[model samples]
Target: MAAWLGWQIESNWADPFVFAIYSLVKPLAGALILVFMYAVIAKDGLHSPLFPGVFVGNALFIYVPAVLAGISWTIIDDREHYGMLKYVYTAPVNVFAYLIGRGVAKAIVATVAVVIMLLLGTLALGVPVRLAGINWLFVAATLVLGSAMLSLFGILLGGVTMITARHNYGVGEAVAGGLYLLCGVVFPLDTLPAWLAATGRVIPISYWLEAFRRALLGHGTEAFASLSDGVLLAVIAGSTAVLAVLAVLGFRLAERRARAKGLLDMQTMY
Candidate 1:
């Protein structure tokens, strides 16, 4: 029911044709920006060996902003926009599950955007992707682990947002930008400064993307080429487990604090 509510909220904004076009056009425009940047920087343009990894990485990175901002925004939207958060809290629904369900809606849209970008890259931009060549199992595992980790992060952010007296939607966007640079979405981590690269190494999303890249292209950046598939998967799973505990604890504490302070129903007009 929560998922259904989320889907309705997301999809009911426009007619199917308009929504579909918005989905395609937004991702397409974003991809074109990267394509133009690659063209200018790489002498070989789209034909360069680095193009596929960069293209695929950019294509998949959309989920970061979608899931993170989507879930966190639910708290702000319900409280500030609709002024029903207090009611929502009193309702007999699991708030955590509702937030996750909202994030799931964003994930569903992100998946469609990803598919459109991949199809465009393969057919027109010459990304050299073949559906028959993909490792479906690995991709599935990576997607699940990565999405779960990201959703936890979103929940943590939402919990924090609940206590904030001021608007902080930019927090999610800031985190997404940080992840884009730190997770090697468009460039290899090794190319970063030594300290920065080390920081990237510890992030689960870095390993997740490396695993995902290998799944799609049968190879990934040399930065993680030394790690076997098992090791990569292990890192992702272990980090996600750790993050799950933290997100739960943090959110519960935030909930308690929000209740004690009577901030759940507070609204910042801005």
Candidate 2:
């Protein structure tokens, strides 16, 4: 798809210094998704899957591989190419700390891209996005906690599958193309079949996206009226807490295993 879109990835463009990083939107979105997937799996386990978010995330992961991949590549290319992987791995900082910091940087970059895309849509393309400004507390809450959960999940995937996954490209592509169909990011959940919608709700992205849209699009007051503000707040807060703890635990475990086996020094491509 990136090739079809005429994206030419050059280490250096016609100009000498600047790198030609085109079609970055998709990858940035993928990073956010990587995080989202981690949260859903950890919190809901496999039973209550966050299909919608997973779908969207999986779809974005194609050429746009998650931001973590980009970060990993930077570390690999610039640092590891110089035989620095072993040095970094031996740092006093625990494995989870390193992973979380890297994940945070990647997720933030993705989010900035998301903001840029929104601005482009409104300013360049004349997309009319009305900011109802209702329940902004919830929207802000979603932006922070929701994104954190997503990032933590991404890190978890990094922890469990980051190693021994020779088919990162294939797996990422399958995820980006297939998962979004369920996420309701590009399409509404109601548009899907009843069974599918119900199933999609089991996924994480749908829950977060729907919750976000309602808060942002002015649909929350009507749809979520049944629940008290405290209840909704609790859900968001709980998701954050759960994801945070798991992210720490997951990264530590993965790092411990990887370091023990000397996998961190193993050759890995972005």
Candidate 3:
């Protein structure tokens, strides 16, 4: 199936040393900068409404570590890990605006990061980026949608983290850390293990990747491998859209309940 889908990995490991560093350093550094930004914000004022901004903004490069780090910082504090959740929910602003702002910021950043990474991959890493089958339009569209979906997942997790007794932050971190790899950011999904691939089907990011590859990288992306394939790009995109809407509703409902019960006033303890 990998061969059929034209899944070939071109290695540049032995390439010019400086180029390799340049290729990897930017994203790593960018990711670190994000972590630092969040850390400073968290330290400066954990109670500020800044977390939603920090949480959504750093997602630009899909650095789950940075994202989770911000998440951890946003929730955990000196006295209590879940400090800011209470105050942020009390603010009078339209919560969706905050959510949308974060999403837009992250999407723009991720798109720019994608451009920078591609340039680094080609110029610095010595990676061959075939322009064949690259559909700039659809790729752009899907990427926007994909980033939005990922942001929604972040929000959903953040909200759920607040109410749940289980400190699944560790598990959530592990899962987020593997998002890019599991979703085939640097590798092809076709190369995923049988079970992993099966699970990948349910993740909207995977379908977006498969479709994005087909639209941009080239044809035979395995996204439209089978017309009858249950996990079609259309289906994944639609499902994620629904999830995004539902997440917004869930946030509203949570806020209302938190206000009514005064849970919003109590300090959250991990």
Model 1 alpha-carbon drift over 4 Å, by segment: none
Worst 10 residues of 3 by lDDT: 2-11
Strongest candidate by TM-score: 1
Off by over 4 Å in 2: 1-83, 123-128, 131-135, 169-179, 193-195, 220-233, 268-270
- Ranking of models by TM-score: 1, 2, 3
Candidate 1 lDDT over 43-99, as tens digits, reads: 999898888998899898888888987888888888888898899889998888999
Q: Estimate, for each residue in 1-270, the C-alpha lDDT of model 3 and write its tens digit.
A: 211111111113345565445445666575456445645755653233333222222323353333333333233331144355455556674544544443443343344555665554445433344566466776666666665566566666555544544454564566666675566544345677978766766676666555544554344344336743234556767877798788777766765665676654455444
Give lDDT for model 1.
0.88
Best candidate according to lDDT: 1
| Location of the lowest summed lDDT over 10 successive residues in candidate 2 | 2-11
Q: Per the 3 Å backbone cut-off, how many clashing residue pairs does candidate 3 have? A: 3
Query: lDDT value for candidate 2?
Result: 0.50
